[model samples]
Target: MRLSRAFQPTLKEVPSEAQIASHRLMLRAGLIRQTAAGIYAWLPAGLRVLRNIARIVREEQDAIGAQEVLMPTIQSADLWRRSGRYDAYGPEMLRLKDRHERELLYGPTNEEMITDLFGGAVKSYRELPQVLYQIQWKFRDEVRPRFGVMRGREFFMKDAYTFDADYEGAVKSYRRMMLAYLRTFQRLGVRAVPMVADTGPIGGNLSHEFLILAPTGESGVFYDAALEEQDWLSEPVDIDDSASLAAFFDKVTHFYAATDEKHDEAAWAEVPEGRRREGRGIEVGHIFYFGTKYSESMGISVSGPDGAPLYPEMGSYGIGVSRLVGAIIEASHDEAGLIWPDAVAPYKAAILNLKPGDSATDAVCERLYAAGAEIFLYDDRAERAGVKFNDADLMGHPWQMIVGPRGAKDGTVELKRRATGERFELSVEDALAKVLGA
Candidate 1:
């Protein structure tokens, strides 16, 4: 998008309301705007980033055999009541009454609703193992919502539900999702350590929270360094095999990782001194194997092999699609501005026209823009070179294709990699080849 004609409104001064790096930078860089306390209107660039993150999430979910489905944001309170959680869920759930005088609530999570839907559709054991997912907005009435999207009251999330016929099958589904989450984080260019966490209102003995290390995080983290060493994307675990999944699960969970709330100093000491890593962490995802919590409460069941009633074991997995935007910025920004990773950047590269009116610079930039206009953010604004440079850095595109009159005159462009601050002056052809991977 050309900055001159774009709706990207950048700020020179940080808003006082933004207390965190991601919050401040997001507003300053024109990624989002606060419409209400803890509620934001994602601007163009921000929406692009949000969609990119969601797309990655959807892809990863699909790879794990999860079928995509769209569930409602507003759930019937009756569903919660059926699950015996309407009163127990507390005020974070926005309970309300419709104009028809029927009770309803904005769903903070979808355990009860999904159980209702799945129960209504599948009655036989033929559909015993199924993973259904959705990328949708969720609401929680946080009394004090803060941290921008990181703790927003209404945010986009990817929640997947898994149903299995037996405890053993549920365990396999749970492990498969764990593997999927790790791979998803790796693809998003972040290392989110899976730590055993409390189930809370979700109500499951088995639960894990994926935390990204950041000083501004809400929880203190303790883990073995080896947990971060493995490349989950390359792991050879067969999702179809229970033994393989179990081995993978053991390989990961045995490494000793936990938040301060669950930290055991004895287990901490058992980790080799060299492998001990303690730091603050921001939660970006969570998974729970609640077994019969929802199915039993909602009276959801399918036929067993012998034709008796069976409550399908249930599990839910979630990745904070919107909060990840903030958590990623919290984990990866520098003094200049945000430093977006390649996979999740709104734009792969930015074309900065240092001399917008100058024919040579315009020619070079226009040529670069033509090469991949959709994938490039062309900063053709009539601004000073320094202004363009600063804005390019602030916007955090992975590559900056600097088009100055001097280089433009020789048909060369200065390409700078934003993450590493590495610059290379090359001919237009070479620059295009490098940035666009020609």
Candidate 2:
């Protein structure tokens, strides 16, 4: 995408309202704009990063056999009433009334609605195990929504629901999802520790919150450092095998990890002093095995093997697709600007034309742009070299292909790695190879 043609409205100074690094940089870098308090309109650049995150979330969900489905943002209040939560959910539910005077509410979550949908169609143990997921917008009337998308009132989220015929099967589903969540975060280039957490309104005895460590996080967390060493994806756990899934879950839970809300002094004392890690953490994802909470409340019953009526055990898994954008920035930015990891960067690399219209510079940039047009953000704006450089750093592309007049004349470009601030002057061919990781 060409900067000149893009609608990125980057700002020079930080907005006073942005209190956090992610919030300030998101505004200064032109990733998002506040349309209302606690709400934002994702600009083109921001949307690209969001879509990339969602894509990764979707791929990981699919790999775990979850089927994608679209659920409505506006849910019928009747659904919540059926689940006995209409009055219990509080004002954050966004209650409203349609023109017909019928009660309605924007869904903060979809447990009730999904239960009703599947309850009506799925009957019998034959349809015992299923996982349905959707990447959609959700709104919660946060009294004070700060930290940009990190705590936005309106944000995109990936929520998946799993249904199983029995408690044992539900446990299996939960373990599989735990594995998927760890792998997803790893691929996104962030270390999110899975910590035991409260279920809250979701109502489950077993729950885990994946928290990414950052200095500016919302809450303090305590965990064993060993949890950071496991590569979940490489572990030989077959999701189809319940025993394997249980073993994997045991392996992970064997480590001491908990947010401050659930921290246990006795357990903390058990850890070796050197392995103890305490830091601020921002929650990026959560999973809960609610068992029959939704199914029982909604009167969802399927036939058991003995032909007896049975309530399908349920679990819900969520990854903050939009909040991740802010979380990534919070966890990875430097003084210059954001430092996006290669896996989730909006653009893999950017071609910065130091002299946009200079014939030599233009030729070199055009050639580099042609080599990787699909994955490159070409800065063809008629801006100063410093302006281009600063903006490239602010946007945080994993690599910057700097095309200055001198290098352009020699058919060479300078490759700058965003994460390390390392620069290498190389011929156009070598630059292309390096950027492509060939």
Candidate 3:
């Protein structure tokens, strides 16, 4: 991907309307462009980042045995009506009549629709515990959509629904999702803490919101420092073992964690003064155990072992796939630009051709680009060294391979790590081995 040929329309000046660090940096980095009041067209760079994030999300969901499915963006209004929410959902839901005068809606959530689908297919206790998920665009007509993707009217989300025959099973499903969410954020290179939260319109007594800490966040959070040090990926929790899952759950919730709304002074006093940590955070994901909320409302049921109809206990888990892009930026960026974590970086490194026209420098860059073409974004444009440096830093690739005329003459190149601002002069092969990995 050569900068000269790429569709990266980076801006020189920040958009006046962008109110947050993520929004401003996203615009200047050419990641997204606003098309409507709360809608956006993800540019090439932005789309790449979104896709990378979604891929990681999908992988983590699959690891937890949740099968992926695609549900339509438009759902029948009657579905919500069946769940007793059509009229109560408020103006945030975009409702309209179709060509045939059939009431429909751009789905804000899929609880009712998924309940109907599940009931129509599975009719017995044997199919009791099932988890299905979809990664799709959702709309919520925010009255004042701002902060770029963070508060957009239209955004991508990963929503998963779970069905269990009994309350006990439903709790297990919820815990499994909790574990999965923790692992997912860890892999995405962000420390997201789970705090007990209100259910809002989703309607659940048991709910947890995952918040990513940032200086400019909407919610102030107080949590135990130990929550930030877990190696969740290495924890051997057998999803099938009830005792194992319960132990894992207890371990996670053992530490006192809360947002301002739910903070308790008595509980705070129990945490060691030194171990208590306070910060602001952005909500990234949420999990809910709303047993029978949708199933009972939609009249979805399956035959029990005793041949009696039983409404399945249910739960909803959601991760704001698109909003996470902005939330991550909010948590991870520096003054220069977005410091993309290696897992979600559009390109692992950018090859800066300091002297593109010079045969020596050009040769070195060309060789390096050829060695790892797929993961490299070649800055082949005839731009000044300072321009290349700034752009590379703005893009925030993990590594920047600088090919200078002098370094080229000596068969050496300077590799700079964006996050640490550390530079190393190594031979062509050595640089390749370091950046591209051995």
Candidate 4:
């Protein structure tokens, strides 16, 4: 996309309200704007990154046999009442009344609603092991929403629900989701550690919070250093095989990991000081195995092989699609600005026209843009070379190709890597080949 035509309202100075690196960079890059206290309007650039993260989540979910089905943002409060959670959910739930005086709410989570939906159509054990997922906006009116999207009241999330006939079946489904979450985060270039966590209002005995360690994060975590070295992507994961899944689960669970709510003092003391890691972490994903919590409360039952009515076991998995943008910045950014992972970067590379009016610089940028590469061309007429350089670094594209009259005259362009601050002089053709190949 050409900067000349793009609606990038980049700021000259950091906003005083942004307390975190991600918040400040997001504002400066024009990726998002605050619509209210904790609600935001995602601009074009931010939407691109959001969609990329969503795509990775969807692909990983699909890989583990989960099917996608969107649910409504506004749901009937009657469903929560049926699950006996209407009164228990507290003030965070955005409760309201429609014109007809019927109760309604912007769903903070979808356990009760999904249970009702599943119960209405799925009766027999034939559909016992089905998983449904959706990527949608969720609202939770935080009393003090801060850290930009990291703790926003209104945000995008991917939530998946799994239904199984019995305990054993449900456990297998939960393991599949765990593997999928690991893979999803790995592909997004974040090292997320799965730590045992409190189920909170979701109400499940078995739960895990996938956390990415960052100094500015909200949640305190304790973990084994070995967890930082495991390569989940290299291992073969067979979701359908219970034994294989069980083995994988055992291997991962062997590591000592827990969030503050579930932290075991004795267990943490057992580890050597060097091997023990204690830090703040961002909760990017969470999964729960809630057994019959939702199914029994909402009358979701399936017939067993013996012709007996039984409540289906249930599980829920979630990834904070919008919060991940902030988490990524927190974990990856430097002094200049945000350092985006290539998988979720809005543009793979940026073409900086150091001399916009020069024929040589324009020709080089035009060829690169016309070659069908996903690039952002800095062709703004009024911007100076220094301003363009600073903007390119701040925008955090993987590669910044600087085209100038001098470089073009010498049949070369300066290619800079945003993450490493490494620069290389290459012919225009070589630069295109290297970046496109990457």
What's the TM-score of each model vs. the native? 0.97, 0.97, 0.96, 0.97
Give the TM-score comparing model 2 with the true structure, all chains together: 0.97
Q: What are the lDDT figures for the candidates, one per model?
A: 0.90, 0.90, 0.91, 0.89
lDDT score, candidate 1: 0.90
**How close is each model in CA RMSD to the real structure?**
1.4, 1.5, 1.6, 1.4
Clashes of 4: 0
Clashing residue pairs in candidate 1 (N, C-alpha, C atoms within 3 angstroms): none
Model 4 lDDT per residue over 1-438, tens place: 888888888898999999999999999999999999999999989999999999999999999989898889999988999989899889999999999999999999999888888888988898789999999999999999998999999999999999998889999999999999999998998999999999876565589999999998889999999888887657797788999999999888888999999999999998888999889999999999988888888887988788888888889999999999999999998888878898999988888888887888788888777874455555545588888878887888888988888988887989988998899999988998888887
Q: Number of clashing residue pairs in every model?
A: 0, 0, 0, 0
Model 3 compared with the native: what TM-score? 0.96
lDDT of 4 at 6: 88
Q: Write model 1 residue lDDT over 52-107, tens digit each, in one string.
A: 99998999899889999999999888888898889988989988898999999998
lDDT for each residue of candidate 3 in 38-113, tens digit (9 for 90 to 100) = 8999998899999999999999899989999999999998889898999998999999898999999999999988
Q: List the residue pairs that clash in candidate 2.
A: none
Error of 3 at 255 (Å): 0.9
Cα RMSD (Å) between model 1 and the true structure?
A: 1.4
